[model samples]
Target: MTAILSMLPPDWREGTFLGRLDLGEGPVPVLLAGGTVHDMSGAAPTVADLVDLGAFDPAQGSVLGSAEDVLARAALLSPVDLQCIKAAGVTFAVSALERVIEERARGDADQAQAVRGGLEERIGGSIRSVVPGSAEAAALKAALIEDGMWSQYLEVAIGPDAEIFTKSPVLSTVGSGAVIGVRSDSDWNNPEPEIVILSDRHGKAVGAALGNDVNLRDFEGRSALLLGKAKDNNASCSIGPFVRLFDAGYTMAEIENAKVLLRIEGPEGFLLEGESRMAEISRPPLDLLRQAFSEHQYPDGIVLFLGTLFAPTQDRDTQGRGFTHKVGDVVTISSERLGTLVNTVATSRDAPAWETGISALYRNLAARGLIGGRA
Candidate 1:
């Protein structure tokens, strides 16, 4: 395989150690040390020799094997060993031949051809108008590019009905690299635990932005006997922060202000008032969100939910209580600087037809002042 090497300065490999391969262009070489990659500049004897020694079967690139092997080799080498090869300076290289070969064998054109023929035969020309340029059409194009297989680039968070935590908020790190912890109770006390992932970005939270603590009350108060398996009985869950940070370019300060808002709607389509007799909170919506993220060490993002807002003791069987979310309930959340993000997650329950019934419900609700307009 043909290799391309990017050279560095004479002292680039001096006292620096290799961790893993960092793909970039710079004087600080990306070192493959201790099964990870890091950027550093120092003097080293022979950069080429070090690279060869760190090489291993790419197919064995699992977390335990190739990763461990890479780390082990770097740990065995001393500073003196690196200094002897300083004449070669430091250089980062990758096999161009291997990359090209992999691309041609798995490129987009070949897959699209295969699917286009089959789709045309089965569905006639119903799908021909759905070209791959538009945003909606891109999903099919992506699927075709991946050879009809489902591909996901983010980790999902899961928990029982009781746990309010989602996979998104917690930050998990190891050695240097990190990912967002999407699973519930991933690390109970760590507050912000490392999710153990390999990526190019640093200093970002992963998974969902925020989760509700109310989901965990039942489990926290229950007896040991009632808690079956610890994994099965947990409550609530979320995921994000990991891919979103890379995707959205979130900074630590920006993440701090992310928050959630809860709105309770009564039968008359008005917000329910808080009663003084109940345990009440008058904290501004943003304040509640800021405090939650700070207290839980949530790095960034918002996980807002607008569901039934009645207190637990309130009569849930009343007319308003029976009203689940409809198409018209307007939910709006905003930050001082971040503006607002709004969406409706409701659908008709008794709609027999797909298009007409659903559209009619939303139109009717809008007329009743349940949707549209400023919140």
Candidate 2:
């Protein structure tokens, strides 16, 4: 049985049923409903399209909820709706209005148009926020990646928020290699807490093990806003080759036998920190992210991020409003995943004292005539 609905052009709204036939095995009867078969190989025509052709009887299947009820439960409703549609069969009826929405999003239209239209209608208004691609935007994005790091850095009068400005000559410190560490503070505040290098890949820890949140406090004494910090360096974030998850596919079960170690040599090539177990961390490594992007629409051979960690540190003598970052104490983060992320002790690096890198980018863009008109 097929549920026919008129959707956008190019058969974007039509759904088809697929059946499997065995030539030599004497009449194999495996019929797949709510799914479309493009050719003899049962391949889907569009990668993003769903195969919901109405195969099963909802009456026969377990009746846990209404059409609206189920829809509410499956909030995002892309792949999940596909599963529900296939399972419900003839007994389940979906409002044509509901199916139109799904079709529009997954249709053959351009991605930008689809996303913009959907957000406007679904979220009750158009998006009016305009931000410059300046340093401020960059800083805020970096701060949001974890929880407390940004706030703490801002509080201590360190990082991009610091008032000092001095450029440091690019120095060759270390080679491109992997390093692992843990969140040393029970809470966020300390910058670059001692990192204990782990083995290549071995060992395990629970309750927010690598990829956990390291919380921090920004404007600690003055405001209620929260911030966070972690070793967001490209090398600091490490992960095992594999991950174990529950059947529902939302929670992490356990990290099976994963260990990490590292050795860091100082200015004279003397060991600064060496041979320590990486028990837990606030974020996952770049390699895992690379694998995930590969499975999706990411372009091939894109290096995700550069190694750099910025945390907040306090300065007692220089507590004032509208502070800026300094050069020597600032940590410049450059990543393939994220663009140049620069943070310094409040007094480092002499640039306009903007609140964020996004502002800086916007300034650069405006100067380049990218914004189309004067702001």
Query: By lDDT, who's the top model here?
Result: 1
> Candidate 2: where are CA atoms >4 Å away?
1-189, 193-352, 355-360
Candidate 2, TM-score vs. the true structure? Answer: 0.19
lDDT of each: 0.24, 0.21
Candidate 2 lDDT at 146 equals: 57
Give per-residue CA lDDT, model 1, range 1-375, as digits (tens).
Answer: 001111111222222222223222211223432334343222211222223333222222233233334333331111111111000000001111111211232422223234433433542232233432344445544554466422110000000011122222121111111111112332110011111111111212221122111221122113222222211212111111111111233333433334333333434465522211101111222332333344343222223221111222122234322122333333332222222222222221221112213345345435544446432
Q: How many clashing residue pairs are found in candidate 2? A: 72
TM-score of each: 0.21, 0.19
